[model samples]
Target: MTNLIRKLWVPVMTLMAITGMGQMPIFKRYYVADIPGLAWLGEPFTVHWVHYAGAAVLMFMVAVITIRWFADREPLTTSGTLRITLLALLICTGYIRVVKNLPDIHFSPTFTMLIDWTHLLFAMLLGVAALWSARTGRRSYTKQTESLRRI
Candidate 1:
């Protein structure tokens, strides 16, 4: 469990922020719409925000733990780069599995679709970051290894 968290977790707080914000209205106005479940559940938008907030908080905690403690070293170094890439991919997967799948669990069409797109955008950014970080780390490692061999 510790290894899994350390090796394969990067939580995106933006998702949490989006969901939490979406759900806030649900607590107050309840649903103005006639969707049967929406009213009973107290505004799906609110529910979305609440869900997002919870996810955000959980992700934030995990991220801090992984970065501060589990990571073992800074990502700018070669050994740490692999760990960072894995963490980023895991986060991307979570966005697909968690927020993107919320529509199936709830009845908010707009909320569901909107979140999916946002998650996709985040995934793209993560992909780029992972690639760049990994390449830089590899180059640095190669240079160090070559210098040591020459010495």
Candidate 2:
């Protein structure tokens, strides 16, 4: 059970995060319009529901990884640390941008540029980290299988 969970943990978390990353507008349009019994769901309610749920799941995953990173009790690679940092930054910047108007904060051109650029940069870095992790995982899996076959 432990081995299975260990093997499946990251992939499952990644899937959940990716699912949560989907745009809410598209979800609202298709799900409420095409699906039955969903028409009664107000646009704001549905949008917030899906968005918040996904954000919660992603945040949970982030917390788990962050705790693992800080506790020094788990084996986390440099790539993993970078990935977590980038993900955190990405999520935070996104949240700020989304809520920027809610606070009635005056949006200057410079501030807007900084937020947009930071978000894009972190997103790109996260993509690189994800690719690196995937490649490393595949290599490790291949080595393990090869060793098992030898036995």
TM-score of each: 0.31, 0.53
- The residue pairs that clash in candidate 1, if any, are 19-49, 20-49, 20-53, 22-49, 23-46, 23-49, 26-46
lDDT by residue (29-143, candidate 1, tens digit) is: 5444446543524556556656655666557656676665434443255544554565566566557557445555663687766656665555555456656765765423112
How far off is residue 71 in model 2, in Å?
A: 5.3
Task: Write one digit per residue (lDDT tens) for candidate 2, span 10-120.
Answer: 665554343333333454555654567545333655544565565666566556655644564454456656766787798988787677646777788899889868876
Task: List the lowest-lDDT window of 10 residues for candidate 1.
Answer: 138-147
Error of 2 at 149 (Å): 20
lDDT minimum window of 10 residues, candidate 2:
138-147
